[model samples]
Target: MSKIADNIESTPHSDLAKGDEHSVKTGRILVAIATYNEIENLPILVERLVDTLPEADLLVIDDGSPDGTGQWCEEHAKMNVRMHCLHRKGKPGLGSAIIAAMQYAIDNNYDVMVNLDADLSHPPEKIPELLEAWRLADSDSTVAIGSRYIHGGGISGWPLKRHFMSRAINMYTRWLLWLPMADCSGSFRAYPVNLLRKIDFDSFLSYGYSFFEEVLYHLKEQGASFVEVPFQFVERQYGSSKINMRKAIVAVWTIFRLGLKAWNPF
Candidate 1:
């Protein structure tokens, strides 16, 4: 079972404007982070987010981290009015944690939901750039992406092998899934909550890191548009990476499967 420790009260969906149309420019925004043993990096991330985006609310979905990451979130939520924490049992998949945040955003009637990693690799200061791009987007279905492959954006502190692996995976996903964006695998993305509501969470096949790419595929199926915002992706300053060879293999296989299904949905 999951538990919530939140400072903000639940706002009714009826409070939203009628006709199901919502504008991100005027609607509430949520910044969500999915974490597992991210306590070492999370505090600094929280501080940066609070300082950088004072108007946006924050949500942390922790998967029962052994390092007391969930506990820290609970304690911090009490002091921060805009922060909320969802504590899930055991170490569930990364995708599930993000799905929970998506549900929370929907339930709370947020118009825009921005998701980022808790490891500080995705810069908190870049969030406003994504939001600004969202505000200026030509369509409401736009998913503003913080892309590292785009011009004016790059990666820092990664070895040649790691860089090659990342670029290869992105290339593979885009070619197979027909994803137009350059950085489809990165977690730094701003999603329109209204578009998220159109997707059926129970139908999703990805429960791991593949969720990042799979989500874009599904969003595109729902007529979602793309807007790439360049941002430098810095390697985490603290804590080891959660991804391993096993996870990467699974993600690749899953993307291949998704591609086949995309070509012929039986």
Candidate 2:
């Protein structure tokens, strides 16, 4: 088991300090979002997130969006003291952007890191809830997943086919990989920064949208404890989804390969 996971499992839940409560010490949290061509949604997302979590810092990782998302973030950074931006030269995948942001959070010594979508698909209002889940569990919990498959959660804008596909994917993943949480594909999540640092970022191989799934699998193998919080997913209002048949095929292939590897150790 990973050192962090071992420590969490060993510690009693009742004794751990709850950071989410108003009485507990408010730790420095970095809310990181990976973006590409989200210029239209950037401002709205920033505004809502900032309003929701004024104490937490916001970091936007833009991968050379032709729509000038980086420039927009730069302008916003000047106005909002807690907002920062990282600009890349070309379109790197979502997974790469998140890795870069996570590395930055670790390097800066932030207490926690929250990853979400800039398209507003993941509700910005639930930031506190996810953070609370982590803090309440103390440092024992490695990840808090904002899940839509849970009882109080569901998707808003997805078509019937997409919804069916998502449900099937999650079900297959659960049966195949034995993932602990309900929504393994959900993007909204919170991580204890110190625990995340324990993951060897250099060894992480996934660079596509499937990175989230890969990270969860790795953490599970390391015995990381994951808590699921119900979240309502709202479809993006502004930009087109980057998902295509190619990405879907890649994700399925990756999941199968990883599942096999997990089941059979050479």
Q: Which model scores highest in TM-score?
A: 1
**Number of residue pairs clashing in candidate 1, backbone atoms closer than 3 angstroms, sequence gap of 3 or more or interchain:** 0
The segments of candidate 1 whose C-alpha lies over 4 angstroms from its true place after superposition are: 1-24
Report lDDT per candidate. 0.85, 0.78
> Could you tell me the lDDT of residue 3 within candidate 2?
21
TM-score, structure 2 vs. true: 0.88
- Which regions of candidate 2 fall more than 4 Å away from where they truly are? 1-24
Residues 1-266, candidate 2, lDDT per residue (tens digit)?
22211111111122112222222356778899988899999899888997899777788887778898888887777776677777765565777777777776776667888999989898889989998898887446469999998899999988999999998888877776778889988789998777777777655556676778878887777768898999899999899999898998888777887788778968
Model 1 lDDT tens row, 46-147: 999999987778888887789989889878877776787777776668888888888888877788999999999899999888988988889999999999
Cα shift from native, residue 6, model 1 (Å): 18
lDDT of 1: 0.85
lDDT of 2 at 249: 81
lDDT of 2 at 99: 79
Q: In model 1, which residue pairs have backbone atoms overlapping below 3 Å?
A: none
